[model samples]
Target: MSRAAGRLKVGIRVPPCDRADRIVRTVRRAEELGFDSAWFPDSQLLWRDVFTTLTAAALGTEQIDLGTAVTNLATRHPAVIASAARSVAELAPGRFTLGLGVGDSSVAPVGLRRSTTAEMREGLTVLRTLLNGDEWEFTGPGGTVRSRLRDPHPAIPLHLAASGPRNLRLAGEVADGVILLSGVSPRTLAGAMDRVREGARAAGRVAEAVPLTVSAYCEVTDDIEAAARRIKPICATIARNGGAPFLALAGIEVDVPDVVDGVYPDLVHAEDWDTAVRVASAWVDDAAALRFAEEFCLFGTADEIARRLRALHADGVRGVFLQHVGSYDPPLDLIEAVGASVLPAL
Candidate 1:
């Protein structure tokens, strides 16, 4: 089946949990409720197997597309990743997408280094070739694998989760889509698109042909302050890690630490709730959160969020991956709300 076009697609990243039945139910609900896609996070040690979760989602959902938000080719060899992706694609045919990324701290805990751009590019090349049913020889520090698909192949779209300019450019050159991280502003999105366009130009392809996806935390509530409070922790952590540079650009001041060494304490160890609120307020305050929610999240009253999303479509955002950072149940409400009120308008 050909991919849909001309409007922003809405998707949600599935939570990592042992309750496969619950996860499957949520995915089915998301599909039935009108989300365009459902994504699984990749973290072998921290979360359940991404492939396994995706398989569950595939079985439970008939219409929604399924894929990894970002899986590292370094953790699993390119051949292994290709095989797993192919297996999942066989389950869902044209509905599977493979979202690849440079391996991060998740693999580091298991004594593996983060993958370099060269490695990611090489791995993507091999995976793409293998997915196309072409025989290929892949040799790395581990070993060599030479194989071709014996079964019928599926048209699995390959997307890269990219943030930096160079990575965005590479994604445009090589991938079917690019997934932008959370906390990006309109200027940042435009800048990233410029890099994507440059890469497409170099590759002799049109820039607009490549899909662009952005991931964000979302919440909807009448009490705006309460919603901002709910979103504080996640925003603070992201700010500490330099994920919210746009906060500074947006003229919001935050005492973000210069270096983030420890994991939990660096984010959670504050004097009081007010401190947490202050640290995160610049990026996650009611108005700021609402602004971000409007621009980045698929939250708010259905009418308001739909208007915001339509504006994003006008601004060239092809897709959004709504991430639930507060309570898990609200995401279900968000899905239903979007389906009942926003999707119809879209």
Candidate 2:
């Protein structure tokens, strides 16, 4: 047997918006930069088709892993999602992971809703079964039907993006890995881990065996406050969805943002830059925003961010994925900075 070499792992998430040229360039760049994976978001109306983008990346790049940073089970059928995931796996071989989540941005635009925990369980079961080429019989419109994947891919992993206690626990029970959305704050991340651990224990599984990927919008900027301001909408989103853990870091509850009441999914992408920051101020004022920057985002100097990242790895974080602020544009600046300073530090 031949021994394989080792490499450092770094994942960058990109949304395939209107620019096909930009997406391809970014993924190719990531591969050149020695990144471990290139993940894409899925929202048919908000961005480009996730599978189409992944397939393109698979054919375009030779080594970098390709995946959905996440796709929603609420919007797509499990059978269909499994088939799409299997097809991508066929292209990339062992480098594809299917990251599933309850619907959010994708469902909101169409006046649909996210799937509940129970729904998620059933959906994952069906998706995994069929992806393994095992006939899975489930009740359809009128009765049950058995089906299997035409091209099975049992190696493809299912990573769940989860935060709420119950849902976090569910990830521990079933997911191959978990995409931690509870923020980078140690307090909240620790709390979220507790929920996941509880779930894993209840399921008779070892929590430590499951890998965890923590994500944040990262940038190296001298003016951290300004960078933080750009992230207000995301802060407000955490508040609106379930801010208890995040709020604990800020020493407050979800009291600041009535401004985000009517916005769908999040105010970050729904409004313009100026309007989004302005509305985010209703909750994330100067002190709060700065605190948010320090505690949650990767928006500090390279030295500072690198130190914290090492601390996160010490805290059991397996890998980190950095998201660019805007969905449509690539974060060349952050990527360059992280590659220069952050990746080496880790």
Candidate 3:
């Protein structure tokens, strides 16, 4: 299952919902649909248990890789995540990647905050050590203690999700792969990749040693204008979080409306997606939404999206995580669309 050095890979993100069976079906379908990986998001109170759903996916399917697009250290202990990751790795063998990140939706509603960059480094160190079956010092509440996994899974690929310069650098220096959150604009991707190279140089390694991926909302439709509008809320969500810097770098300006400020648990977590999309459309508008699609997202017809993806691969992106527009469940139709139209061209 060795990855061809410069080949592009596609993965799908599925939210585990109240119906565990549906999540399993979605993951299996993603596999059958020719995706390279199945990524699950961990937002416990908002969705089904990540590990539980992933376990089900692992048992029901073979061949497709699987992992968290991200889980966080604030909500789950590094040792625990490391152990849980090992269990999934055992199920899929070389197909699991442990993608870690600063807390987002998974923590915010519970009033937990993301870890500082220094804390993230410490967390990764702890997880990597424990997964190698070595004892590591754990510190928190009372005092520091040593812990280790009895039977470790040492070779699981560890990917880090990052957006800011410093975090991107950290990912380059330490991560086996980086899930770039800067979106897919050529300028933004170029800037983020520079940071990655900087970190790799600092760590005394080649920049190409680390793989890179970016997530994009995917839809295959004849109506370009409508699809552009549908991606507005997602574009707005990206704009509010560390996106302003990259937007400025790319000469793109998106107005973040006051209404967006009042949304709870983040815009992407809204259960009533129709309302969320409607509210987002006010600020995102037609011009800005279409512009966001041009610069950030991978939304369009199969041929158009595939051409853009090929450009990404040429520029060093090894993977793309295609996201569905809804909140509670996997968008099965979008999965089918990507499989039929985009996968072949890629």
Candidate 4:
């Protein structure tokens, strides 16, 4: 069952690694540039608090939607998440979305376990109940306690960021929306959506009614082959972590170490991206990187990107939040370039 195509909402991922005011300015700039939404990433050690950034963005901008590209449940308890989501919803009213994901950067650094699917289901149930101004029961060593969030905003949407089969199905079954981590590849996206639709059908929900949002790495460049070399780390990281089949769809093969040492945080969010690319090149060559870029990423000129985005919209992608290559830096250039050139063209 294919979803009927609709207007494609374009959003940008702004890492909240700077001061709250600076982050707000970036979001304001995005709004001025005609971008539909500005998404922020949450990593305690890597960036400033996501809620703090969202709070400032809420007050600074009047129109553009605001959301976490995602925050994780493992690092925060469900009750705390309820309170935070409620607080942000109050600030932005109909514009706030709370996106949750299995802890990656947030938990690995602290030696904490990521949320399991069962845990995610339980957490979503608790969050939904509390955010709707109802009580949720928590069973502990002492006894079962019931608590409800104050100043609840039932309008706040809960989006799940998922890439795996199980989590993707869970998002389809329970979430208000889905943040798809499978880039913009038609083949992989089709497979991921199949899993999602199966789950929604199992839950007796109309699969096409659920909102789909894609997260992809994007750049506005004429020299795509040269630019593709920078994303070698990303290509290798995805293949290393059980996404080789997705790459196989684009006819690219890579073999990376299960554990790649020397990168500070991880291969995807490595501090020295150049060194990371060099290391990953042992497995993923320039030709492979170019194929990944052409098939998976949005790396091309303005016209090229706009055309690709149109294709994605035709394929049932409701929204796409573009990410620049690096994790720490703000996508100011991307926002300006795509906002001026690509958005107007679209």
Candidates in order have lDDT scores of 0.71, 0.79, 0.82, 0.89
Tens-place lDDT digits, model 1, residues 2-93: 24876678888775555666778888888887788888878776567888888877777788888898899778887788888888888887
lDDT winner: 4
lDDT of 4: 0.89
Q: How well does model 1 score by local distance difference test?
A: 0.71
lDDT (C-alpha) at residue 173 in model 3: 93
lDDT tens digits by residue: candidate 4, 20-48: 99888889999999888889988898899
TM, every model: 0.84, 0.93, 0.94, 0.97
| Error at 157, model 4, angstroms | 0.6
Model 2 C-alpha lDDT versus the unseen true structure: 0.79
- Show the lowest summed lDDT stretch of 10 residues, model 4: 1-10
Best to worst by TM-score, what's the order? 4, 3, 2, 1
The per-residue C-alpha lDDT of model 2 at residue 44 equals 83
Task: Compose the digit string of candidate 3's lDDT tens values, residues 235-270.
Answer: 777777757667666555666753465455567888
TM-score of 2: 0.93
